[model samples]
Target: MARTYSLNTEAAKEANNGGKRINETGKYSGKIIAAFYEKNQKGTESVNIMFVSESGQECGPLNLYTHNSSGEELAGYKMLNALMACAKVQGLTWQDTPIDLYDYDEQKVVTKTKECAVELQGKRIGLVLQQEEYQKNNGDIGQRMVIAAPFEADTELMAVEILSRISQPQALGNYMAFIAKNPVRRLKNSQASQPAPRQAENPDPYDDDIPF
Candidate 1:
């Protein structure tokens, strides 16, 4: 399939790689628009999920790696269950996906399947959030609003003790304190301060005067 450019649209355009929404610490609600099974180099299997809120705030491409390479049974499995329960996401439909292929003729990489890995898109999710601030590669601080809390799309239940154990909201007192003590490191830029070498000039590359 070809691509279409939405040059003149009032849509929520995605921020280029390191972009984030400036939000506050509170309850957030959204739906899971993307989810698919993924595996790591160590053979750990996971489902990567991403969310978008009503006001266009995004949370993740967060990974829930339950199938561990180290084979620790029941570790991190409960979190995955919470997501399914809240979203009412039942009946997983997994398929044989092709992850290693390139189409040179189309000049693109393609995976042909019904939603490819597993169709878990458009499922609702809720979170208790905090706009955790951190510095960036270029010495500028940027806000990253990570979504997905596994709470119902209506409540964070932040105060209840039992709620904390079950729901797993982002910024409970314990987690927030830990974060304050050890702030998240800035995003690493692979091409950090790399030289941008200019291409060799064609002398008059933009000269439109064709003589012939």
Candidate 2:
């Protein structure tokens, strides 16, 4: 049976935005599960081959007409190719097993995905997969897979350490530091940046004597 795909407005928006970012260097790791093709419906042209995320979470039906490039239209297949390449590099294979999509809501999936992304990001020192975008593709692909690590500093260092334990270490300390500094700044900025006050809180006078 074909998998059902569903997404609320937010997921659809994010997926659509991610799809628009695909470029020649294959910098965009997000996949397009569906494509648009011309079909006659009620004597008018209509969309065909709508891609959907396997989990049916935030993703909505993706129309193919939105894609501007033939290569971009092949996003799903390209992501699969990248995943297979990564597996091969790590001496892994998918001969008899089926691939499973990572569920962002699940703790195990979250940990595994973060770990993989962090390692690759650390090694590369200059790439970051839009994580929500990655999640959408994860659902679309419906398989256990991996990608090159993201370039976010903390993720980079974590990834480097993990990969090093399994293989050889490289000099990414500078890159890691560069990535780390900005996040720290952002954290501080976020703390300092507060929204303006709204109405004052209403105190519950009747509960003043309640037990702690």
Candidate 3:
């Protein structure tokens, strides 16, 4: 029998859960639409990078907490490596010196920070989403930070273009709001398709993104 293969748009839609275009494990192929620095009440600083699906759904404000108040690395190196990979894919230059997370906080530092800002804004990437149970701002068990990874060869290319060019801000906001309202349930692996058990209490952020 001859082999037949085709993109299943309907299945894809179902897997995406009417949100940003994503794969079964919730892998997103989109560009970084927004990036900003956020400081928690405890004075811990982190950068928030948001990726919008090609369909204009906001998939994440992926947090990269570079340092604590004591100046310690907290998942900053991983994020830097991902950024370097993204730069390599786009043919951008990067320095071999130590990465300064504070540089990312500013709009200057042209060669390093500025370039990263420009490249990440509207540039395509492959974001990996890992679901975890957390307490929402409203005291609901529906909050989780959808993590992301850098672009890779096997990354699914959905919404091949950027979302800003195709969607209005209001529409994008509505999509994000919808996502915020709906709790992200854990997805089973492709092979099993069995449901995973939910935890009764909040825990640390799930570290399940594919190693880069």
Q: Model 2, range 1-212, lDDT digits (tens) per residue?
A: 99898867766765755543222111222223322233233333222221122222212122113233332333333332222222222322212212223365773422111112211211212222211112234444121112222222223222323322323323334433443432221222344322222212222212333111
TM-score of each: 0.48, 0.20, 0.46
- Pick the TM-score winner: 1
lDDT agreement of model 1 with the native: 0.50
Q: Point out where model 1 deviates above 4 Å.
A: 1-26, 95-119, 129-148, 155-212
- Candidate with best lDDT: 1
Candidate 3 C-alpha lDDT tens digits along 1-212: 99898998866775656644332335456676645555688777675666666565665456778778877778654454454344333223322322223244575433323123444555666665655455556865553655533443233321211111222223223333444444354333334233432212211112232222
lDDT of each: 0.50, 0.27, 0.46
Ranking by TM-score: 1, 3, 2
Q: Could you tell me the TM-score of candidate 3? A: 0.46
How big is the RMSD of model 3?
16.8
In model 2, which runs have C-alpha deviations exceeding 4 angstroms? Answer: 1-69, 72-96, 99-170, 184-212
Which pairs, if any, clash in model 3? none
